[model samples]
Target: MVGVETSQHVQLSYEPAGVGDRVLAYLLDGFFMGVYFFVVFWIWGYWYSLGSDPADLSLSWVFYVVIVLPLMLYHLVSEVLWKGYSPGKKIVGIRVVKVDGSRADLSGYLIRWLFRLVEISMTSGVIAFVAVIMNGKGQRLGDMVGKTCVIKERKKAKLEDTLFKDVSEGYEPVFPQVTELNDKDIRVIQDVLDARSHYEYDTWFKMLKRTRQKLEARLGVQDHGMRTDVFLETIIKDYNAIHGSVK
Candidate 1:
C-alpha cells in the first residue's frame, strides 16, 4: 500500500497494482488488439488479392490509415474518453490518478500513451514491470512522465465520513471568504476529513493547523476563539449552504 498525500495533506491509502496484475491487464488488452488486427488484416489481404498489381489499389493506404493508426491510438483514445480507465484497466479494477488526488487530464493521458510504445511495446513490458516494482507507484515510463499512478479502485469514503453538520436555513455563515476556495478545494478538505484515520493525531493536528491558517489568511480574518476542528466543520457547512455541494 502506498500512502498518497492529497492536496489537503490527507493520507489516502492506495494499493498499487503489482507488476503481475499490470502484465495481466496488458495481456487482456493485447488479446483484443490482436483479434482486431487479425480480422482487419485478413479483410485487407482479401482486398489486395482482388488486384493483380498492389500499386493499382487506390485504397491500399486505407489499411494503414484505418487499421494501423487506430491500433496505435487505442490506448490514448480509450484512456481519455474513459477518464484514465482503458477497458483493460477497468476490468482489472485499477485506474490512473494524479498524485494530488485530482482527476487525470487529457495531457496526462497523452503523456502516458506516448511513452507506452517504449515502456510496454518495444521492451515487451520488461521495462515497465521493472520500473513499477522499483518505483513502488505502479508507474511505467509513461506514468512517470505523466505524473500519474495506477491504483486499485476501492470503495471510497462518502460525504458522511466528513461529519458535516446540519445548518438551519437562517444560519449565518462564519466566513464569507470561503468563496475564495473552489469545489476542488472543498473536495480536498472533505478528503482530508474523511482520511483522518489513516494518519497520526499529530499529523492531523498539523494539517488542520495549516488548513486553518490558509483559510484565515485568505479570508483576512483572525481566529475568533473557534477550535480548529469546529472552524473547519463550519467552513464546510457554510460553503455547502452558500454554493450547494461542490459540483
Candidate 2:
C-alpha cells in the first residue's frame, strides 16, 4: 500500500501494480493490436493483388496511414474515453489517476500518451521498468509527465470508504447547500470522519474542525446548533439522500 498525498494534505491508500503486471498488460495489448493490423493488412493485400499493379505494393502508404496511425493514437483515444484505462490497463485491473486523487484531465492523459513512444515503444520498455522501480509509485516516464500513477483496482474494506450511507425516513437535510461540494470534497470529509475515533481527542478535533470549516465555507452555513460531529454526519447523510433521489 502506497500513500498518495493530495493537495489538501489528505493521504489515500492505493496498491501500485508491479512491473510484471505492466509487462503482461503490454503483451496483451500488443497481441490484440497485432491481430487487428494483420487482418486489415491481409484484406488490403488481397484486394491489391487481385486488380492493382504489383508495383503499387511498394508504396504501402495506405497501410501506414490507415492502420499505423490509429495504432499510434490508440493509447491517447483509449485513456481519454475510458478515464485512464487503456485496454491493457483495464484487463490488468489498473487505472491512471492524478496524484491528488482527482481524475486526470485531457492534457495530462495526452502527455502520458506522448511519452509512451519513448518510454515503451522506442526503448522496448527498458526505460519504463527502470523508472517505475526507482519512482516507487508505478510511474513510467509518461506518468511522471502527466502527474499520474497507475493503481490497482480492488474491493474496499469499509462501506464508508465508498461513501454510501443509509439515511432514514423523513430525513430533512439541514443544508441543501451541501450540493456545492463535489465527490473529492465529500471523500475527504468521510476520511476525516472515519479516522476520528482512532485518533487522540485533540488530534481528532483538529481534523474535524478543519473539515467543518471547509464545508461551512462551501455551503455558507454556520452554527447550526448541532455538535461538530453531528453536523458533519448530517451533511453527509443529507448529501447521500439528495443525490440518491436524483439518481
Candidate 3:
C-alpha cells in the first residue's frame, strides 16, 4: 500500500507487503524454527543422555554451540544467505529491502535480526504487530532500526503513470524499425501492453495479434522468434533507447 517512486519519479514502482502477508510469512518462519528446534533438541537430548560416558562428558559445551548458537543465528544466517529472503518470505513472495527501494546489506539484516530477539522471541510478536500496524510503511521494530521494509512481489504492478517505461540497463535495441512509431502510435502500443493484465489470456492474445499486425505493417518488423509480449516490450524499450523521453 505504500508507494515508492519508479524511475524519474514517474510512478510508484513497488508496493509494501500488507500486514497479513507479513504475519503469514512470520508464522511460516516460526513454524520452521519450531520444527528445527524440536529436531535439534531431540538429537541433542539423546547425545546428552550419554553424558555418563567420560568421552561425551567433556563436550557439554557442544550443546550450546551446536543447538543454541544456530537457533539464535537462524534468521540472521538465512536472510543473509538468501539476500533478504528467509525460506518463509520466499514462499510468501516477499522480501526485505531498504526503505529507499534498494536491497539491504549484511549490516541491515543483522540489525533487524538483533531486534527479532526482543519483539518476537521475548514479547511473542505483540510488539512487532503493533509497530507494523501503527506505521503505514509496513515496518516492524527491526525494520525501523535497520531502515528496511518488507515488500510483496505477488501482485501485478500498475504502470499507468507515464509513458516512460524504465528499461533495464545494457539493453540492446533489437528492432530499429521501432523508430517508425510516432508518439501516437507508441502510445497505442503502450496502451495495448498495459491493458494485457486486465484481460483473460484469449482476449489478450487477440489484442496482441491485432497490435503486432499493426506494428509490423507500420514498422515492417518481424517477430524474430519473440513472444507477443516480448516483442511489444522490446519495441517499447527500443523506442526509449532510440527516442529518449516520451515527449
> Which one wins on TM-score?
2
lDDT of 1 by residue, 17-73 (tens): 777777777888888889999998787679788875566544657767878888999
Score candidate 2 by TM-score against the native. 0.66
1-247 in candidate 2: lDDT tens per residue? Answer: 4455554565446678888888888888888889889998898789887898767665668657779888999888988899978899899888788865567899889898889999988999899999999998889888888898887876456654457677777888879998887767766777777765456778778777777876787788977888888888888888887877321
lDDT of 1: 0.77
Rank by lDDT (best first): 2, 1, 3
- What residue runs in model 3 are displaced by over 4 Å at the alpha carbon? 1-11, 45-60, 155-247
Model 1 — which ten-residue stretch has the worst lDDT?
156-165
Q: State candidate 3's TM-score.
A: 0.61
TM-score of each: 0.65, 0.66, 0.61
lDDT of each: 0.77, 0.79, 0.76
lDDT per residue as tens, model 3, 1-247: 4444332222223568888888899889889988988997777668768665646644768767866788798888988889889888999999988887778899899999999889988999899889988987879989998999888774544543435676666777899887777666665666666655556778767777777776777777664788887888778878888777433
Q: Which candidate has the top score in lDDT? A: 2
Pairs of residues at least 3 apart in sequence or in different chains that clash in candidate 3: none
Error of 2 at 137 (Å): 1.5
Residue 103 of model 1 has an lDDT of: 78
